[model samples]
Target: MTLANGGDNIGIYTPSFAIRSAHEIIVIAVVFVVMTALWCFVAHAIVNHPKLGSPIRRCGHRVTPFVLVGLGVLILYQAGSFGLLLGRSGF
Candidate 1:
């Protein structure tokens, strides 16, 4: 996922900078590693944190895992829309 978006963004703007292929590969590798680390952190937080589950039961429909998931979806939607703008603007 990061690769598709990152590669498109990089390929668009890096042409003027004349960046090398190796550098582009390095950037993608770093992005992949960072994204992996973040995934691990979020997964661990949701799985190991008992408080996260407590809110769902204690608060009924007002508080549930879907709320947290929705927040993540919102964030991703913003990122994707921003990326689309960048892609179209070629910046």
Candidate 2:
């Protein structure tokens, strides 16, 4: 079996793989949980802030579409699709 990183498998699959990876999995899980909790807390605080919340609520609808479009363009550029499109168009 090929490893997730694309390395050649060095030995037969065994319980040792799970044992060796358990700690890494646990650490990743803990970090995910902590980050999610922190994000929730920060978002709640921001939404409840007197000075900041109203402006965000008012502008969020107007700004979100542009932000999402920008993010999509960024992703396409990173994936080289923008270059492909430009090349096809003789840019």
Candidate 3:
């Protein structure tokens, strides 16, 4: 996104920066969704299955509550973002 025209005098940003920002937002969303789904699957596997008796499964069972809370935090973050976009506190 190099919009600098030889650095003679003018200062202007490139148009592609906006597109880059949009791409970053989409990537972040996809990453969050994938991570949340993974966490839930691991949590459910540890909680409900009798065959998954490994140390990692024990850890996942213990960590499932916090994973759920982390999901709540993620949702709160999205709510705050929507509030910022609307220029008001989310009711």
Name the best candidate (by TM-score). Answer: 2
Q: Output the number of the lDDT-best candidate.
A: 2
lDDT of 3 by residue, 6-90 (tens): 4521211122123357777678668868997898898677756676657665575688679756755555455464465578765
Clashing pairs in 2: none
What TM-score does prediction 1 earn? 0.31
Can you give the lDDT of residue 52 in candidate 3? 61
Better of 1 and 2 by TM-score: 2
> Regarding lDDT, does 1 or 2 come out ahead?
2
Model 2 off-target regions past 4 Å?
A: 1-38, 88-91
TM-score of each: 0.31, 0.50, 0.33
Sort the candidates on lDDT, descending order.
2, 1, 3
Please identify which of the two predictions, 2 or 3, would achieve the higher lDDT against the true structure.
2
Worst-scoring 10-residue span by lDDT in model 1: 11-20
- Encode model 2's per-residue lDDT on 6-91: one tens digit a residue: 42222222322443477866785687689978988997899789999999888889997797567656555544555556786221
Model 1, which residues run further than 4 Å from truth? 1-20, 51-91
Backbone clash pairs in model 2 (N, Cα, C under 3 Å; residues 3+ apart or in different chains), count: 0
Q: Which stretches of candidate 3 lie over 4 Å from their true place?
A: 1-20, 49-91
